[model samples]
Target: MDAYKKAGVDINAGYKLVDDIKNLSNNKDLGSFGGLFPLSLGAYKNPVLVSGTDGVGTKLLIAIKANLHKTIGIDLVAMCVNDVLAQGAKPLFFLDYLGVGHLDNEKAKDILAGVVEGVSQAQAKLVGGETAEMPDMYTHGHYDLAGFAVGIADQAKLLSKANPREGDVLLGLASNGLHSNGFSLVRDILFKQNTYSLNDRLAGCNRDLKDELLRPTKIYVKSVLPLVEQGTVASIAHITGGGLPENVTRILPDNLSAVFDYGSWQVPAIMKDLQKIGHLSFDDLLHTFNLGLGMVLAVHSGDADEVQSQLQAAGEIVSRVGRLTSGDKQVIIRKDQQ
Candidate 1:
């Protein structure tokens, strides 16, 4: 061991991680100080590269508190890839950055495994990444994850912002419970204010709080990418920190608004339970959490049924949640079910 190893850095463990990631990504040449991806411009006639980078917010605290390191990486990957997918891009490759106070070989590998799994799930290659071991930077057993994804879309095939029009139908894709957004509030309400334990179980929830909260953010790549490629989707919204109101409004043109039937689709029991326990207003719930929908899309009225059929065939729970109406940019949630 060298002086670096004596000073809390394990050189061999770093090398072991590099080797493991290299094997996982199948980029044997990644050890060359920088990662490389070979793209044949010949494959695309005028391509636009789309890039996105995102981190799993304080939701990471739940994973750390519960000592569950496996799925945060998946959330990390989903956060990035899904954003890129919104623009109709096919993810080509992904890279990750992990920073830690001290290197624990087994734990590090366990965490990275989810990244590898996420990349695979996105049908993208994990081309490169960096794992930094800094003793003073992070506290013991503390780490942070950031992911970057690069993808390509043909210029003519992009999911442009202007595509949505009045009379278009909005499709709501089901979310797997709190998919890595507003978790700081979630922790504050459940764990801090309410004093709930990780093992605590609430009504209408089949799993413990830890299991429910740590459920990985869903990756929409495999489900929605096909629609993007086929040009069946007019626009898309990846529901994250802004929830449905903020995210859905982003893709809408100024002349249009989305009007949703509140009771058209079932809000996940966990989210409803959170609302009841926290006494969160409907506005807060719409803007702070996904409720039950993860990705909402705009499809032409005629194409809506076919798109829903295709999405369902691709194994997604699809709901025609709303429609585009002529108005200033807004989201209207009818009060019938609230």
Candidate 2:
């Protein structure tokens, strides 16, 4: 074996992962210096390319602790693709980066499987990815995941905050669970302070904590893209690391802020459990986590009901959670004064 192989960097094994990815993604031509995607797939006179990148965050620690590696890639893909989707882009291709101390075959396969599945779900191509086995860089049997996604949208169709009016309604799409954020706090509360194991089933949760924690981030591309294409959406926000306040403010006009009714939607049980355990205030929860809303849209008031019904028919659990108002604060909380 070579010196690098002796240091746990296996060229052959990594190539094996490449082969698996090729077969899994059906992209035989993927090992170039840069990935190539044709711009002629459809017709758009003034095309604007959009791209985004993100990682799975500390949620990977929970997955690794639980020995549940398959679904983390889904979270990786969701974190990346959904961001690009927020700007009314149709994601075209995806790539992933996996850094590990040692490459275990079954574990690598499981991770790649989730990536392939996520790409299929987003209707995008898995154009390329990398799996690096660094001996001392990461702890033994531990790895981290990051992903990149590129999308395309027309100039006129690009959604922005400037277009949202004062009367626009904020429609919130429900999150599956904790979609890969606030995990450092989650781990601190659950493991460090509360002494709860990943195997420990909470009082209200049907499954164990690990299952709830490892629940994959929902990809909103398929759900929100149609609404974007219809020209009904003024702005879209993907609820990620910064939660509602920060993420929603990204797409809010200076003259218009969003007013949310906490009572208009139900916070997920897992989140409530986290709040009670950590003694985290409601403001803390809103800024730190999704609080059950994954993707929110600012749309015309007249089209709110139709958008909700159509999104429901398209298999999305959506709620009319808020509205745009004249304010300097980007997001104002009514706190059950609905």
Candidate 3:
């Protein structure tokens, strides 16, 4: 009713937008009736379907505030796709769910554009999605996004934490910026320092703070997938909501631990700002944010150099951040010597 719009949900617009993408989402792998994958499975002795679902968290607030909605859809897709890839799966298809308090056609279109863009980048299909217009649930012009990604990998090829051993190298892939995690703390620091305006230009980055903040989470699907073919990759950790310490530890086997020499790589300027302003301790920063490294690759010690060279040649910012050590499952962060 009219009151629904007044309350912030525009149900009619939501219906039309969903109809708009239906034609564009025709995937041969996806069935007319159900989620589909009807291909010859002659290659794998055993094929395992891997799936992951994720949403861009409160970081959507930053995008919404900056009026930059396109890339967050990229973040949504990347978040889900990248996670499945961590398990050594090849992303085959993706589906999204959008919930908006009120619907605006232009805004919905922009968001879908991003999803399409991300799917294209990841070489995955946008099979289908859901858009909900729930008036009372969100404020006007505010919406949230979540995505589901399905990938496939041979059961024997799946990266397992069962054998992450001591002396293995931790190769880190660089992040563009914050990459969809640690925004809450970052926002707090910026606001407390009175630096929340997206329009304001950052001093050294030569871009608006909003531009830097809302940068989409990097999709590691392209860069790391090839390595899976080599069978040298032991495990991977997609550093997300719980920063390096927690995330890296997640994929590490019980007999293994990470010994990070924090000085090994340069922390990006944006994170440096937070560290300086918040006076947050080392552990807090490492456990709460990616800092600079976005994805960590746990590779066999013999394959470390080759992997690093391959990644760098691919124009990826890769570094040997640390090594696995013989210890209880723990993340050891060593301070840079001043």
Candidate achieving the largest lDDT: 1
For residues 217-304, could you state the per-residue lDDT of candidate 2 as single tens digits? 9998887888888887888999998899999999987888899988788788888888999999988888889989999988899989
Q: Candidate 1 regions off by >4 Å?
A: none
Candidate 2 segments whose C-alpha is farther than 4 A from its true place: none
lDDT of 1 by residue, 167-286 (tens): 999999999899999998899889887889999988999999999999999999998998888888999999999888889888988999999988878788888888898999988888
Error of 2 at 142 (Å): 1.9
Clashes of 3: 0
Q: lDDT at 100 for candidate 1?
A: 92
Q: Native-vs-model 3 lDDT?
A: 0.83
Task: Rank by TM-score, highest first.
Answer: 2, 1, 3
lDDT score for residue 130 of model 2: 82
TM-score of 1: 0.96
Residue pairs with backbone overlap in model 3: none
Which is the winner by TM-score between candidate 1 and candidate 2?
A: 2
Give a tens-digit lDDT track for model 3, residues 1-338: 89977776676776677666664454543324455555557877898989999998889888888888888889999899999999998998898888887677788888887898899888888887777877668884789899999999999899998757789999999987888888878778877656557777555565788888888889988888999778878999998987988898888777878988887877878777778778988777887788788899988899999999988887799988899998888988877632
Off by over 4 Å in 3: 1-12, 22-35, 192-195
Candidate 2's TM-score? 0.97
